[model samples]
Target: MRIGIVGTGFMGTTHAKGWVETPARITGFCAETVAEAAALADQYHAKAFASLAAMLPEVDVVDICTPTYLHLEQVRLAAAAGKDIICEKPLTLDVETGAEMLRVCEDAGVRLFVAHVVRYFPEYAAAKKIVADGKLGKPGTIHLRRCNYRPKKAAGNWFLDDAKSGGLLMDLSIHDFDYARWIAGEVKTVFSTTVGSMDKDAPVDYALTILTHEDGTLSHITGGWAYPAPNFQTGLDINCERGNIHFDSVASAPIRVLIREEQNAPDVGLPASPLAESPYTTELKEFYHAIAQGEAVRVTALDGLKAVQIACAARVSAAEGRPVFLEPQGGVL
Candidate 1:
């Protein structure tokens, strides 16, 4: 398949590298500037289009790695052209836009895949499999932490603007929110607290959110841009009735499991495995395969919509200093 990538920023470049590892051809790119698109296109031996409309007919699939705010328009254009779409996380900045994007793609009869890459991370994927296999029994409390320095190279410092990037919670913490839902089921309410600034000159920002799931599972998710260095760290702790699973990026062995005595399960310790290929590659390959085979994508557009809903709710809870209860629509909050 021929792929057209939108944006030439970090995520766009990352997606370009990922598509290279697959059998698909990197047809071209459309970015904020022709110069930027041309720079990335040169690295991939591809063309640079001045606009999305100009590039649409040349590619079979459109990989949208643009900023959160640009997603709705780019998706609408691509879907209108009958091109399958691969959009980056959070889908859009709010529920209304995300819902409209999904509706347009559905009406166009084109497949839409959201790139929730955290789900493809080896440790996270393994933990999910364990839960699916009933190895953890009924999960109870989940704690997730993802911390990193604020993006020093984000174009125009967009990451600091809550209006543009949704600050740390929507852009950074959304991963943990999606993962929490994946493990614990639907969220019933969200309570959150935040610290620090959204100012461009601010050095630190942090947010902590508690998600109460319908199944009685509680998820405490923390995200921070307060790290002094340009370091990234993530960890997860899952408590289940019969046992527990844990992962820490800083740990010698990142993944560990322990079962209660009555459960009679052997403990498992998993050291991080060296990757022959990046998880981004694996994620893109799966997306391509699903399109090719006319099968269901691993990450659906609805999953993306729900994640945005949960993240938006978290923001509301933080702003109002109260628990935000979710009302279900067609069994999804």
Candidate 2:
């Protein structure tokens, strides 16, 4: 498989690092400018294209790591070129365009995978397995927290724009929203509240969302952009009929537990994983195999769209200070 990257920011660099671990060949890169593309391409010993149009014919997959607002156009171009796509999270700023992108890819007979890397994390993956294996009966209540500093950006950067970045709910909290839906079930309604501002000069942003699943399972998600660098942390606690699954990035070990007796505090002190490969790399490798050999991946374009739908509903709930109801989804792609 041959791939062409289309961004040069942090995610772009991180994706590139993962792509290198796959069997796919990194064919080229196309950034906001040819110079930027060339800089990243040079590091990977790949070609640098002046435009996506120029890069399309040279690769089988167009890896889109561009900003959320720019995804629709880039994805359309890639689909038009008859190439598969690997888009980063949030998919887009809204579900309408994300659905269109999925439709375009499907019509063109190309696979569309979204990078929801949290699902691929070792701790999260382990939790998923434990839940699936019936170690924890049915999930009841889930609490997910992701906190990190505001993205380091220059003045007038798009990260500060609510319309472009979708603030913290879509940018950061979408991970939890997606994970919540994945672990519990489809969302039936959402109620959310937010603090801080989306102003360019604002130093912080935060949101808390509550999702009521179709099966009555509840998920509360919190996202914040007020921490210092290197202080970023993610924690998840899932309560179930049998036991609970817990993980905190700041802990010595992120783990899953099976409760036997209702007496005494459950013993819990699992150790950190010794594996060197990152969840990002594992995600990309899975995507590569799915595209190259027709395997199933954890995240698809429809999943991405639904994630956006959930996040958008949260945005609306926050804006209106009322619970937003979601209709049963049919075919959008």
Candidate 3:
């Protein structure tokens, strides 16, 4: 399969690397400038197309690694050209646009795969499997923490712009939001509190969102771009009626599970295995295989839409200082 990548930023470069690990050919790239696309194209031994329209005919699949706001137009262009799409996460800045993107792709009979890479992470994937397998009977409370320093190299300071990047919650915390919903089920309500500044000179931003799932599972998700130290950390603690599963990036062993036994016995911790390949690579490979085999994608466009909806709702909740309840149809009401 031929692949054309859009956006020559960090994510665009990362997608190029992941695609190289697969059997697909990196046909070329489309970016803001010829030089930007050429830089990435040179690394992959591919061409640098001058425009998305020019790049479309050269490839069967378009991998969109552009910013959140650019997704709809890119997806529309690709779908119009009858090309399959792989879009970067938080599909679009809003629900209507994301829904329209999905509708266009479906009407065009082209596959739409959203890159929610966290679902492919070994630890996170295992946690989902464990919960699905009933190993953690009736999950109750889930605590997820993801913290990292703000992107110092964000050109034009776009990452700090709430309208552009959706600030820390949409761009950074959406991973945890997706994961939480994946494991806990549909979110019924969301209550959120945000602290820190979006000022260009400010060094920090943080947000905490509490999600109540339809299944009665409560998830407390905390995300930050405010760490003084140069460290990235992500951890998950899932408490269930039977036992619990935990993973901390800072821990000696990243993942561990404990299951209750014989009514009242000591909890026995079981070690979780590590992934041989990066989740990004795995995610691309899965998308490739799904497209090749005409099978269902693991991360569907609807999943991406729901995640963005939740994140957008969180933003509303934080702004209004009230818990936002979601409709059964995945909209805040």
Candidate 4:
């Protein structure tokens, strides 16, 4: 599949590399700024365009790597141009725009995929499989930690602006939100605590949310861009009825997985593959196949929506100091 990427920022560049590494062919890249587009195109060995309109006709797929506020319009443009879409997480900064994006893509008969990278992480994927196979017993409670030191360059930028990026819950914690849902099933309610970002006037950086899933599972997530350093960490611990498992420090090599029973200490497994490819590459390959076959994508627009909804609910719960329900629609439980 021929693909056109919009935006030449960090995520844009990362996704471009991922697509190139995947089976799809990179047709071109477009950035609002011509210089950025040209630079990325040169690096990726693809054509460069000054605008989305210039690249749409030449590519079968449009990958949106733009900021949150720009997603709705860019997606609409791609949809109208009859190109499949692969968008970054938190499809848009708000629910209405996100829903509209899905609607337009659906109406245009274009597949919509979101980049929820953690879902593709090898350790997380293995954890999900183990849980599905009942090896983790009945998933009872989960504790997750996802955090990073915000780059000084990005600390007070548009990413921190609630109106522009929807702050930390939407911009960052959404990953953890998606993973929690993926592993444990539907979320029923949440109570949260949040603090304004250290460097910005907006609220994008810090939060701790406690989620209650419909299956009587409790999950907790803590995320932020306030580390003030370059390192980042992510891990999840699952406590089941009969056993427990943990996947920790997955971003680096030798990812660890710990398993234990009621009477045992634990068994730890390290990375088995010496040269494992990145999860981003795997995710894009899946997107290519899903689009080609007109099949449901691994990271569907609804999954993105559900994640955003949970994040928004968490935000409300945080601001109000109360638990918020992940309400059923149309009286359907």
Candidate 5:
């Protein structure tokens, strides 16, 4: 498969690297600024295009690594070109555009996969397997935490702007939101609170969200760029009918388990594979397989929509200071 990439920032670079490591080929890299695209292309040993339009006709898959606000337009362009899409998360800054993007892709008969990398993380994949294998024995409740310092500065300029990045929830918490959906089931309601830096003008850097699921499973997520830690920290704890499973992002062994005395402790460590191969590679391979074999993607556009819905509801809850129902005004995609 030949793929074209849009945006060459950190995330774009990560996704591009994943593609490079996959069996598929990276045909072109695009950026609004042609120079930026050219630089990334040189770095990754791929062709450079001035814009998405220039790359659309040359590739089978369009991997959108642009800002959250630009996703709708870029996805729409790719759909119009009849290329399959792999988009970075937080489908869009809002629900309307996200739903529209999904609709466009569906109508175009294009496969749309969202990069909810947590779903593909080795530890997460392991945790999912353990849960599915009945080791967790009917999940009861979950707690997820993802936090990091914004530094005295941000890694990128767009990330600091609320208009482009969707602040903290659309930018960061969506990771946990997607993971929570994968682990705990459907969300029923959400309540949230946010604390922004007094010095920043755009969006809050700190946020905490409580999600109530349909099955009475509760999920709490806290995320921010406010922590003084040197690196991002994330993890989850699932309380189940039988036992509990915990994973810490900061740990060398990211996953761990404590079952109710029946089983011995299991040490979950990151596999000793080459850096070129990771859950990101696994996910990219899945996308390639889906395209090659004409199968449904594991993480569909609708699944992506649901994740955004969850994040949006959390955003509303935070702004309103009340628990908001996770009701899709139109319906689920």
Candidate 6:
């Protein structure tokens, strides 16, 4: 399979690095400018195209790592050209646009994959496996934290634009929102509150959202763009009926899963395998093979849409200062 990347920013570079290690050939790249694409292409030993239209015919997949606002148009073009798509997260700025991207891809007879790469992270993947294997009875509560320095770029960068980037919740917090849905079942209700981000020009922002999962599980998710640059961390804590699972990026150890299946049994700590492979590479490899060989991956288009729906709902809850309820729309939301 040949892959064409459509951005040269951090995510685009990160995804490019991942794709090179996979079975797919890094055919070429195209960004807002040929100069940027050429730079990334030169480093990765691939060709660079002046436009998406020019590059479509040469690659089997279109990997979109552009900003949140550019996804709809780029995805429409890629799907119309009959190329499978790998869009970086939040799918699009809103549920309506994201759904349309899916519809366009479906009508074009191509696959639409969203990169919710957190699912492939070693620690989170391990916790999910424990829950899936039912070794911890059932997950009852989860707390997820992700924070980093606010993105900076040219004067009018879209990162801070609420209408364009969906602000912090849609752009940053949605990772844990998707992971929460992955660990538990679907979300039933969402209540959220935020600070500093509502004005769209705040120097830093923080948001806390509480999710009530359909299966009686609850997830408390916190996201921020307030940390100092080079000072970032993400951690997950899961409390289950039989035991507990925890992982902290700053923790000086592997993921610790404590199992206590019996009423009086001693708690046994099992350390998972250290993350040897980049989750980004694992994600791209799974996506590459799924496209090449028709296998199922950890994430799907519906998962992407559901996550965006939940995130959009969270934004509404925060803006309206009320709880928002969600009803799954048969299959699509």
Worst 10 residues of 4 by lDDT: 264-273
State the lDDT at 192 in candidate 3: 87
Q: What's the CA error at residue 188 for candidate 1, in Å?
A: 0.2
**Per-residue lDDT value at 323 in model 5:** 90
lDDT of 2: 0.85
Model 2, residue 201: C-alpha shift (Å): 7.6
Please estimate how well model 1 matches the true structure, expressed as its whole-model Cα lDDT. 0.85
Name model 2 segments beyond 4 Å from true. Answer: 197-202, 253-274, 331-333
Clashing pairs in 3: none
What lDDT tens digits, residue by residue, belong to model 3 across residues 243-313? 99998887845465566544431121112236577688899999999989887666788889899989998
Q: Which tens-of-lDDT digit does each residue in 79-141 have in candidate 4?
A: 998888999888987666777888899999877899998888887888888888986588888
lDDT of 1 by residue, 130-194 (tens): 98899669999999998876666524777777787887889989989999989988899999888
**Candidate 2 structure quality by residue, lDDT tens digits, 1-333:** 998998877778888999999999999998878897887899999998888889999999999998898899999999998999999988998878887888898898988999999899888888888988997799999999888777766445677678888988998899999999889878999999888523445567888899999999999999988776535678999999999988877784444455575443111111225469878889999999999899999877788889999999999998878999987756453
Off by over 4 Å in 1: 196-202, 253-274, 329-333
Extract clashing residue pairs from model 2.
none
Clash count, predicted structure 4: 2
Q: What are the models' TM-scores? A: 0.91, 0.91, 0.90, 0.88, 0.87, 0.90
Clashes within 3 Å, all models in order? 0, 0, 0, 2, 0, 0
Question: Pairing residues by index, what is the TM-score of model 6?
Answer: 0.90
Worst 10 residues of 2 by lDDT: 263-272
Q: lDDT scores for all predictions?
A: 0.85, 0.85, 0.84, 0.79, 0.79, 0.86
Deviation of model 6 at 321, angstroms: 0.6
Q: For residues 87-198, what per-residue lDDT tens digits would candidate 6 score against the true structure?
A: 9998987888888988999999999999998999887888899889998998899999987767776566677778788988998889999999999989999999988525
The worst-scoring run of ten residues by lDDT in candidate 3 lies at 264-273
Candidate 5: deviation at residue 250, Å? 2.7
RMSD of 6: 8.3
Residue 120 miss distance in model 2 (angstroms): 0.7
Candidate 4 wrongly placed segments (more than 4 Å): 152-156, 197-204, 250-275, 329-333
